[model samples]
Target: MQSLSGKTAVISGGAEGIGLALAKGLGALGMNIVLGDIEAKALARAQEIMTDLNIPHLAVEMDVSIRDDWQHTARAAQERFGDIHMLVNNAGVGGGMGALGNLDESGWRWAIDVNLMGVVYGADTFVPLMKGHGEDAWLINVASMAGMAGVPLAGSYTATKAAVVALTEAWSTELADSAIHVSVLAPAFVKTRIHQSHRNRQARYAPTTAPGPEVMKMAKGSAQAVENGIDPELLAKRVLEALDAKETYIFTHPKYRFVTDERSANIAKAFDSAAESPLVADVAEAPMALGFVDS
Candidate 1:
């Protein structure tokens, strides 16, 4: 997308926060905005904003966690806008908020379904559609800084985000031959409703037990952090600017680079020790002797 005008950009969770900001920004750029969200009221509000700005748009009430919902969104987008040039898998929920997860099976399932599998389903449904159009396309998956480095008391979130980063990186490489460019947005924190994500959690994903004091405290702290975080508008702006770079990894906050740098340094140090190990050399020589590996 060097020229986003007249193209279609479908964003999940586009009802509020960063998603909504992205919708507004892209809409302002003269692109057709398709807002996919689970909240009807938020969707209505978003549509109002789009209409007020005179931006061509469509609001679809759909849960990104459901595979069929993604298909529905795609069908609706195709019918309304024809070709989809951008897909932003931005729907996610904060879950298992405790060290090692103080959550039940339901909590775990909710996190994985909405955060991880949602992105997977979006890619599965939209890649072919974009490919068929024979035009350049973009896939931006929203992960967290926790994806770069584990955060204490946020095991489930960190795990899913890390998986998202891995998936996006691999897809970027695999899609290198195609015009579909993949990028993962890994931001530290933003002024979003993610801290209050429980409000929208489905009944099926309800926890068996109420949150303990520690979890409650963590939630309070998270709310504060979110309130103090960067504005979603700035994040949305960064995203649009980053799309031009066509980089595999994008970020809204560069102050958190140290976190990723420290993690990478530690992993490199550990790998160095492993490579020097006698057992590692023995396995390497065996592979070479068998001609299974290049010299």
Candidate 2:
């Protein structure tokens, strides 16, 4: 994982924003790039950028939510570059804004499918291939700081990202003995098009109800925050540094460190309270509930 030169990296959502920045940074390091994106126009633009840089690359129009799309992307990468050394699960969407109960089921499904399941599909499809190479590799799953500390009016998006964080932690443990290194990138707002992610919403997952007043207010504020957020290229540089350092958790925007610390401190306080409460003793003495065992 220390050396990136001559490595091959397959990055989903690589047409624009942070993904495109990552492609540029990694390509500059002499790594072969394979860009996958749902938008054909953006993919074309990304291809042009890569071409201009004289970086060997392949652009594949791919919907990360679709398993077949991932399979095709993997095959294309293998065919173009012998062994995959990096897999960047960067595709994600900003789900509908509303209270948890007020949000449409479609919104939840769309967020989970694209943000969480997309990473799962990428890892499942690529990990075996990477393992076969028997060489050092890296897997970067892009989550968000909102996942670390839940944000109001963005429950679905936060939930999906938090799940990604947990999954990456588990994968890090499971793949500890292997050459594939797993890391989750938890970044704060960046100057990306995620605020306009609704433009790419699938028809089936379209929001059924208009956002409430609070949701709309939050959306406007979030959009403003993103407009003034950190640059994507800066994030890409940090990601490359993390890879070289083999860091498990890659965070951008250190200003948000207080928020993460507050969340952790609150959880720790709750744990302390539970440890001192009589309820803990009662729960420990309670009989375990039995469940059906699959045979």
Per lDDT, the best of the predicted structures is: 2
lDDT of 1 by residue, 88-192 (tens): 999998976764545556777888999999999999999999989879999999999989988777777888999999999888867877999999999887998
lDDT of 1: 0.89
Candidate 2 ranges beyond 4 A from true positions? 281-295
Residue 52 of model 2: what lDDT?
A: 98
Instruction: Kindly list the per-residue Cα lDDT of model 2 for residues 79-156, writing each as its tens digit.
Output: 999899999999999986788668677888999999999999999999999999889998999999988988888889
Residue 111 local lDDT, model 2: 95
TM-score per prediction, in order, is 0.94, 0.94
Residue 86 deviation, candidate 1, in Å?
A: 0.3
Residue pairs with backbone overlap in model 2: none
Worst 10 residues of 2 by lDDT: 285-294
Give model 1's TM-score versus the native structure. 0.94
